[model samples]
Target: MRKPWCSTSSLALALVTVIVVGLAGAANAQGAAPAPAGPPPPAPTADEIKKVTEYYLRGKDVGPILMELVVCKKMGKSAENKSICEEKHGDTLKKGDPLIAFTRFFVPKGAKYEDLKVKFLLNGEVRSTSDFTLQESWTGYGNYKQTTASKPGTWEILVLRGETQLATAKVTVVE
Candidate 1:
């Protein structure tokens, strides 16, 4: 019953209304709240946090631990002289005497990670480099002894974890 021209006009109007509505929806979506400033920090899972807490409570380390070093000479020709015995044994080192390096690594109980390599530096030059760990056979924690070069200079212990230097201890050798 509708006229032909009137029907075509209605169809055109409907199409225009649809386009306007679509445009309004697009505008509303664009005006809405922006996403966020930057990416939010990644949320750590509950299990991950619990594991970290457990490790901290039990004193477990991942990266690096504390290191202690002492440089000294033997007391005399006693049996203890052949070994690193007491602190007094680590006094000043003399020429032609034994240079003992006492080192202690702070780690969890039963953790025997021997990834530490130490270099005995005499006057900024590497005299010796070796890997050692806690040993029951030794008198002290980690006792490393070598004959003195009979040269008066500076003595340094460079502690390295992999290629990185973790700690350093130094002493002076006298004639």
Candidate 2:
């Protein structure tokens, strides 16, 4: 009796099967989830980028003046070794999503060393406050993660040095 040809083709198929099974087993063992099957969301627009940098200075030109502000979902480092927004947000943000703010300031070298107050306001009410010490011409950031109790409305971020307001930024929260 002649046996069927199960030599080269059969061995090659068997090797492929083993390799696929091994890869699947490894993925399962490591708890790896496949990536989403689509392109990422588009980048922020020029208007959106401009909105974040728009701030009102409350007093005379002084040290620690807020130079640039950015609201983003995440931040990343650029190839030039500078900080950049990974996911820039527009004026409206999801109610339950975290609010992240990055600020750049021009602090005169001779400026007094003091704490700058960061205020988070909802409508006209002060929702939260924190202190960030001014660095000599440097960058700082704040993050407010929302909870189930978080409400939707207009929110403001005010940076103050003592009683004098340095700058103010605003955003809207929506469901």
Candidate 3:
């Protein structure tokens, strides 16, 4: 009989070439090559990221809402749990008068109970800061108690969520 058109070794070599090409094409079609085998990355450490002081509403980019911010002579809540402001005064506040900075706000849906901040500033200087839990209807208040050391000048109240300033109210304080 005539010798086979291809030797056994050549057939084997041809078969190996076909398999390598097929595997390469399949890999390309699937995706990139597999990652090199190695030890897993080190676990993250707590100090890697700084603690976040500001928080977003409902994990969304939206911020909280401040409906009304008033600086009044007196502030209290009614028996029905509604806010009451007496002698609403923003034009000028008498030094040593019972001064109150009250704010009514609406926390975004799913953001209620989250922590917010109210800052009391006197002539652009932070006098005090208070934290309040966002309520469904209204929340926030800061008492600008006029102490002997309390300076008489422009007083401001600011509502903030994290680094975002939501609202601000200004009142002039007089001696």
lDDT string, candidate 1, 77-113, tens digits? 4442333334433435666666665554444323455
Name the runs in model 2 displaced over 4 angstroms.
1-62, 77-83, 110-112, 138-149
Worst 10 residues of 2 by lDDT: 140-149
In TM-score terms, candidate 2 sits at 0.51
Q: Model 1, which residues run further than 4 Å from truth?
A: 1-64, 75-85, 88-92, 134-149
RMSD of each: 25.6, 19.3, 23.5
> What's the lDDT for all of these models?
0.54, 0.57, 0.56
By lDDT, rank the candidates, best first. Answer: 2, 3, 1
**How high is the lDDT of residue 14 in model 2?**
78
| Candidate 2, 64-174: lDDT as tens digits | 566666666665544422344557678888778766656656444334446677677889798887776653321222222222216799888776778888677788898
- Residue-level lDDT of model 3, residues 30-94, one tens digit each, is 43223236998785443331111122224324545666676667644443223455557757777
